[model samples]
Target: MIAFPDEAAGCPLTGIVASYTPRLAALAAEPGFVAAVDQHAAEIRERLFAQGPELMPRPLRRAELTDYALGFLDALAEVGWDQPVGYDYAVDRLTAICWLVHQNGLLDA
Candidate 1:
């Protein structure tokens, strides 16, 4: 498992991933998975912005936010929870998410 900095653990992206990854892995091919991705991605965007510009990197860009959230979701969708590979993939995705959020300069409250 990826260990996010204590600060970033509360982030909504982190929340969504931590909460949904297992479910997603099990349901990736299910009918509503695509909708769920969209819904969660949107929620991530809303929550991120709600954290305020003061908490984010200066000159925040929308593109990066979308890319990271979507990419994370896509990663989760690619692996099955029942497979050992899925565990590794989850770790990798978590790592990427932590790095991206930090690289973008989001500060935890």
Candidate 2:
């Protein structure tokens, strides 16, 4: 079992996803947006490799990233879906998502 201090036990991904699902869902609905995110991730991969391979892990395909994004949104819907989430929060989530994709890749890939 994962143990976190009570004050920090809330999952950042879960909270961020829950807070921003509607916006993410809307973006996910657009093929253009998904493609752009994939392209951006590819760029990120290149930049990350420039830093060094030791910093990277197994690369994730664009579809896998999209699946994770969409799944996060779906999980959010299961909880309270009426809370208002800010645009800034949505942007932050997007940035973090891209960073996650980058971190999950290896330089050789």
Backbone clashes for every candidate come to: 0, 0
Pairs that collide in candidate 1 are none
- Whole-model Cα lDDT of every candidate shown, in order: 0.46, 0.46
**lDDT tens digits by residue: candidate 2, 1-109:** 2111231233333343333344445555766655655565465445434445576554555545555555645655566344344333335445456455444541114
Model 1 Cα lDDT, one tens digit per residue, 17-105: 44444554544575454454445434555555556556662444535564555565555566533334433444444434444454455
- Superposed by TM-score, candidate 2 places the C-alpha of residue 99 at a distance from the truth, in angstroms, of 7.0
Residue 14 alpha-carbon offset, candidate 1, angstroms: 4.2
The segments of candidate 2 whose C-alpha lies over 4 angstroms from its true place after superposition are: 1-24, 51-109
TM-scores for all candidates: the values are 0.31, 0.32
**Number of the predicted model whose TM-score against the real structure is largest:** 2
